[model samples]
Target: MPQHLLLIEDDARLASMVAEYLEQSGFSVNHCGDGLSGLAHLTQPPAGAAPELVVLDLMLPDIDGLEVCRRIRALPAPLSTVPVLMLTAKGDAMDRIIGLEIGADDYLPKPFEPRELLARIRAILRRKVDNPAPNGKTLRFGTLEIDRDARTVTVAGAACDLTSYQFDLLVALAERAGRVLTRDQIMEAVRGRELDAFDRSIDVHMGRIRAAIEADPKDPKRILTVRGVGYVFARQQD
Candidate 1:
């Protein structure tokens, strides 16, 4: 089946251009020009027509993209799992960081190279299929819990929603608790590939996971940064 893409951008020309390019790249693209309409379209997709990916624009006519992302995360199945790539004209690091902090799988500045957007989209999809830990499987460690099978994580049994990357990071650390895995090892284990740019995406994912599952993300107990080596999940004796 051809992968489906939902592009939510208010700019008519940009929306058309992206749809055409993505379709040319073998994707079935759907465009929603306004935030309210985008949410409406998302609420009612075609029969069994969940999108494989979403391209979200930060500035929307009705609601901000950040709010949309939040709502999407609050969704169940198909919609919640759909990978999102945020588009913003803001190039500042803070803006980029905010997008990531708000659960965007990836971020691209406006006037981005089409190829780069496609690369990111492909990378996210690859990670989604290749990672395979977010299908409602749960792994528990003391007060910490990871439910990949349901994609629902809990800290002290409190429900938490995690992105695909965040879930993989926790699983990597938890699955190898008490042992130090180098950043490279964690990357390979989570991404299933050798690093191309050696990006700190692993660290970013870890931050999000810890923020969700730890009482203190700054000083996490469940997942510990081992200074020079890498990271280890704090072993809890059964």
Candidate 2:
């Protein structure tokens, strides 16, 4: 079956164009003009059907796009876990950073090409469906435990709250514990793309992940930053 997508964009023209393009590309697209209605669609999806992804615009009629993204993240699981791709007209770095920090799976600046949008959507979906790690594999390091199949992480027996992207980032680091990976390496491994110059989305995401899994995010022990390099997952958690 074609994938289902919810597009929360206030621009009527843009929404119609995007919906048509995505539909031609073999997706079922539902468009909502405002944030509140969009949130409702996400929260109370059709009785038996829910969108596989959300393409959210940063500008909205009711609530700001950022707030909408937060509300989506706050939803109960499987809903909260749905991937979000943020669309913004803003070229500011902070906007993209904030979007990713708030659990958006990907970000696209406005006036983007339809093809690129399609590619990004495909990439995010790929990450959702493809599990690189062997099934049933679990990585244990002292108080931290990562279950590959379950896609869950726990520190000291307490479950950590992580977005889908954050969970993937953590798994990528833990799978190669003790080996330092550059930002390029980490992004490519988890996102299937190289880091964009001046884009600190990865760093923002790392900070969020640390906050979720580390006993003290300010001084993380599991994911250590290497000066002038990238980051590493400690082999020994003690």
Candidate 3:
């Protein structure tokens, strides 16, 4: 079955163009012109047609994309875990960073090619299907537990809030515990693409992960930085 997608965009012309393009690419596209309707659609999807992903716009008529993402994450399980790909016209890196910090799976700046949008959507969905961790395999480092099959992370038996992409990043680093992997290597491992030179999204995700699992995000103990050598998951941890 073709994957279903929900697009929350206020720009009618752009929404039509994106929805049409995605439908042509074999996805079932449901477009909402405002944030409220988008949330309502997600909350009450048609039978057997729950969206596998969301294409969200930063600028909306009702509420901005960031708030919408936060509300989505706050939903009950399964719904909350659905992947989101953010679209933004803002050239400011901060907007994208904030989006990632709040649980967006990925983001594309405005004026992007529809093909790139399609590619990004496919990549995010692929991560959902092609999980890097083997089924039923759980990685444990002290108090931190990563259950691959369940796609969940817990610290000391308490659930850690992590987006789908953030969970994958933590898994990648944990799987290669104690090895220093550069930013490019990390992105390649998780996203199947090298990190762009100017992209700090990976770092932002790392911060979110740390905030979830670490005793203190500012002074992280589980995921450590190696000065100029990228990051390493400390094999030895509390």
Q: Pick the candidate with the highest TM-score.
A: 3
Indicate the TM-score of model 1.
Answer: 0.81
TM-score of 3: 0.96
Residues 24-125, model 2: lDDT tens digits? 999999999999999899888776447999999998988988999899888877788888999987586788888888889889998899999999999888
Tens digits of per-residue lDDT for model 3 on 1-238? 9899999999899899999999999999999999999999999998877899999999999999999999999998888989999998758788898999899999999988999999999998888877686645899999999998889899999998888888888998999999999988888888755567688888899999999999998999999999888999999999
TM-score of every model versus the real structure:
0.81, 0.96, 0.96
C-alpha lDDT of residue 200 in model 2: 75
- Candidate 1 vs candidate 3: the lDDT winner is 3
Residue 196 lDDT in model 1?
44
Off by over 4 Å in 3: none
Alpha carbon lDDT of each predicted model: 0.77, 0.88, 0.91
Which candidate achieves the best lDDT against the true structure? 3
- Runs of candidate 1 with Cα error greater than 4 angstroms are 76-78, 131-138, 143-152, 155-158, 181-185, 192-204, 228-230
Between candidates 1 and 2, the lDDT winner: 2
Point out the higher-scoring one by TM-score: 2 or 3.
3
For each of the candidates, the C-alpha root-mean-square deviation to the true structure, in angstroms, is 3.5, 1.3, 1.3
- CA shift at 169, candidate 2, in angstroms? 1.0
Q: Residue 154 lDDT in model 1?
A: 74
Backbone clash count, each prediction separately: 6, 0, 0
Clashing pairs in model 1? 135-149, 136-148, 136-149, 136-150, 137-148, 137-149
